[model samples]
Target: MENDREGPVPQNGSEGPVPRVGVAVFLLRGKTVLLGKRRSSLGDSTFALPGGHLEFGESFEDCAAREVKEETGLEIDKMEFLTVTNNPFLDEPKPSHYVVIFIRALLRDPQQVPQNLEPNKCDGWDWYDWNNLPNPLFWPLENMVQSGFNPFPID
Candidate 1:
């Protein structure tokens, strides 16, 4: 196997592959959702849901909480799994990944405007109605937005 930082994975366990788990959060308010642009060396410069790779031993819910905080500087509670995607575009080496949990969360007291916390992870943030999100976003994210699905149960 070559030094594949973000490569596809072999079918069997014989390959020493990388195991990565990414968690994304869809923050919603009155049908408008928050979106961000990927920065640094991961993902394209296109728009994307706010979330990132999970740290070792971190639960999907925890990762969602942490990432939302780290990237948006907004405290969120009541996270729920919206969907999971096998996203390989994050890295090149190893079998893409096992899971990418998409979480739908409610932002507590959302700031009047968007702010960037992880300068290297995202350049800026913006709010838009889920139906009117910007185009040219990461494919997976666009699918999530277009689906209009919410994993969180409603009363």
Candidate 2:
């Protein structure tokens, strides 16, 4: 096989790479939602919801619950389908694409504060007002905000 690809070899021995699915969570407490400042991985230094890549053969809800616990050390409940996003990492040296699924969840116990369980992946977790989110949100989250996706349910 004559390889003329400019970047790294595609996975699974395919000629083209496939887009991955990402799962991001929205953990709300009243008007505030939990967000973590990313420290490593794709969107380092940007704030993102507490979730990660969807595992093979796992349901979206399952991935959401698992990711939140793995990253924030807090159990979430009452999950609701939020929204979806298509993100492309064009600026990166390596080409990457992701379709992110956003899930809205509530803390199993409202009083249970979040902890940064994966210190290498996140700086810390904090609750912030939806309208007053911190600057430099992750690409998927920024896309969600731009589309006016609110975590609060319409009453």
TM-score of each: 0.75, 0.89
Pairs in clash, predicted candidate 2: none
lDDT of 1 by residue, 29-142 (tens): 767778877753345577877876776788888888777777777888778776677655544322355357788888777554557876666668888776566777766776
Lowest lDDT 10-residue stretch of candidate 1: 1-10
Worst 10 residues of 2 by lDDT: 1-10
**TM-score of model number 2:** 0.89
Highest-scoring model, TM-score: 2
Candidate 2 residues 1-155, lDDT tens each? 00001223367889886777778788889999888887755677888888777778998899888888887778889999877777777676667777778888898989787887877677888999999999899777887789887889889
User: Model 1 segments beyond 4 Å from truth?
Assistant: 1-15, 40-42, 90-95, 111-113, 145-155
**What lDDT does each candidate get?**
0.66, 0.77
The per-residue C-alpha lDDT of model 1 at residue 21 equals 66
